[model samples]
Target: MTCSPPAAPGPPEPPEDAAVTTETVTEPVSTPRERRGWYFYDWAASAYNTTVTTVFLGPYLTSIAEKAAGCAEEGQTCADLHPLGIPVAPGSFFAYALSLSVFAQVLVLPIVGAYADRSWHKKRLLAWLTAFGAGTTLAMLFVTGDRYLLGGALLVVSNILFGAAETVYYSYLPQISDPDERDAVSSRGWAIGYLGGGLLLLFNVIAVLAGDSLGWSTAEIARWSIVSAGAWWAVFAVYAIRPLRDRPPVETSRSRSVFYAFNQLGRTLRELGSLRLTLFFLIAYLVYNDGIQTVITLSATYATEELKLEQTALVPTILMIQFLAFGGALLLGAVARRIGAWKAVLASLVLWAVVLVAAYFVPARAPLQFVALGAAIGLVLGGSQALSRSLFSQLIPAGKEAEYYGIYQISDRGTSWLGPLLFGLAYQLTDSYRISIVSLIVFFVVGFFLLLAVPMRRAILAAGNEPPRLL
Candidate 1:
């Protein structure tokens, strides 16, 4: 999702010998069309976030691995398989695959962000990754019975691109919204995403629920769902690629060499101490966002393995989360206007802690309880995430929004790998998803106190922006 505005026509530059010069000028306010176009990518990208990442792919891929490993039926005990000489419970395959994808992102995305900030073609870069990722997602239709490796490989590549593109997408936030308007704009994008994700998920849920009567196997239905998400992502992405303006490189001369980009990055790293308050906030966000993301990525898997919910119940339960998340994001944005975005975020984090504790005790046989848990989670999911990005924007230096956002994106998507990896390891050791989930509470607890301690006014002033108006 490219949030930066397109280059509008400017008055022609004066000839070198002309006595007068014209300065390139930009509109002070974003037009409605530009705002809508900015929101489109979030709307489009959410399909994959919901259908492939959050709901279907992990559980479905695990089933494929289980079948390949000769496991049959629910309640049958399957021996741990070591496909690559490493012990792996059948349930852990998809989670581990997710962790692997995050690991790749942690290594690649920083450089990608640095380069994207220096490239004149942010729109093209965003489009290339979107198409590449979406194509890989569509290829999941071919990952049948014993093709777990193909599924895993495709997921790794697509998910990495997803994170990489997001680095560019998120950096555009400050470019579009004024400080006072950012929370609302970011929340709107998130809410729109949930709406789009929910619509596609609604279709997938129906397909899964009706598969038996239609003479299609459950696996067949899931593969189709994955492909649909890709189609949704590709089709909606065009709105962003075509309408939103492309930004010139943040620093034109910096774009001249690959080494120059990293050289600048090295200088930024050396200056981290000057931005220590923002550093504190980043750490706090890193921990808590990890918990939030871990729950999101693995919720369906947890419900399937621990709650024993059927696909019919599980998929619809996820659909419920999607709708609720849309409302929740918008609600928090409104509430943040009254209570301050920082306090609103703190409130959401507390609710997250409540959700984790409540999830641990939800009885496996009670389908209604699982549905309720999904609702509670949806309420805080988008609120916390949307606000976090906006709040971080306030702390970044002017003219270096994209450069600093590279580090912020590192916290956003780069940190995603650690949570899944830790979650996977916990499951590998305990074979209890309940225990693994509850362990994530430590991150939330730590992040809360750290956030409470950050000097907001100081951070804003340090970044050379006025302190945000809480009301």
Candidate 2:
């Protein structure tokens, strides 16, 4: 299928001079080169998602936290941290770090997203945020032997920048795609990102394993992994900046300054009341995605701590999930075409709830638990997230795609806080990982009902026809 570029705003300046200067001008559709370049950003960015956020860095950071808090000793294994210090416990630091990152994301993502939308240099902003995130991730190398504060600080920076970069990245999507092709283009990008992320994560795992076998310190191996993540980010990001063309900033009157941007933002917020479906979907996404994210973040700790899985088993399990996610994303895209994006999303959410229930019942056997959880997550993770992106894309106003997507990012980030907090709270109150796992099902159930209420066709039409606003 082919997509035409959106109609040029305001009828092409009335053809400039209608007299002898009859030079014909054609507006270019987004080219294959530009589309590939745009997709490469996902490829570049996914290294962070797979290696640092999902598979490697969390475990590594938890190790650092354990050591720093004196709950574990060099070359000696220890139990997972408690939910909070709570009068001397092992894993308190882990809970603290997780909570801190969640809190920071909620506070920072919306404002940063709003600023990125109002500003002209989104690519540049993405670059800076990505670099900062990478650098902070790299700084984890220095967090050897119980440096909890340093490790926590690095994680805080990494998480903040990660969220900030994502806000900008999602906002950029509609700016560079025609409406007709957005779904296919977005799906393809997601598929490519999963593949790329899996490949890079495999390489990082090899490095860490080799480093460990060579009698290198865990700290040294971890440092190398951190550096690799940064390198991967920097290298692939080049594609995004090189072939992409920036949209010109909207001209504002002299009366409209930086403060005016805030006024425009306020206006947009007020206008949001009319975009009820969009608002509803945003609320729904917040509830469910937070559950997804919390599961992703905490699964490794659960495997290692509760199931007694070694790093050998845990890392490979994660790598398997990454590779499976590649196929899962593409497969879900096809499923979306068949059943509609909303139904597809609902299906994935239902699957997730079932998976959580199954996880609760899985015996204490590490391999069995890993296999069950891994397979279930692999099926739903990519589908739910990719469909959500496309679904939200359909809901946004046409020329105001960036502005509305910024609001979408705000919803995404804000919704992220609840699940992790719930997981941590469940763990604290019940001291049962099984209960914690089961509790996340509420998010999926609530989000599914809310999503069911959204009018997909209306959203698609609104996104295609709405006028651009300053916000």
RMSD of 1: 4.6
Q: Write the per-residue lDDT of candidate 1 for residues 323-432, one digit (tens) a residue.
A: 99999999999999998899999999899999999999999878999899999988988888999989998887654656676776654632376777777888888989
lDDT of each: 0.80, 0.68
Cα lDDT of model 2 by residue, 443-467, tens digit? 8899888888877676556544432
Q: lDDT, candidate 1, residue 346?
A: 92
For residue 50, what is the lDDT in candidate 2? 72
> Which residue pairs in candidate 1 have backbone atoms (N, alpha carbon, C) closer than 3 angstroms, thus clashing?
5-245, 6-245, 6-246
Candidate number achieving the greatest lDDT relative to the actual structure = 1
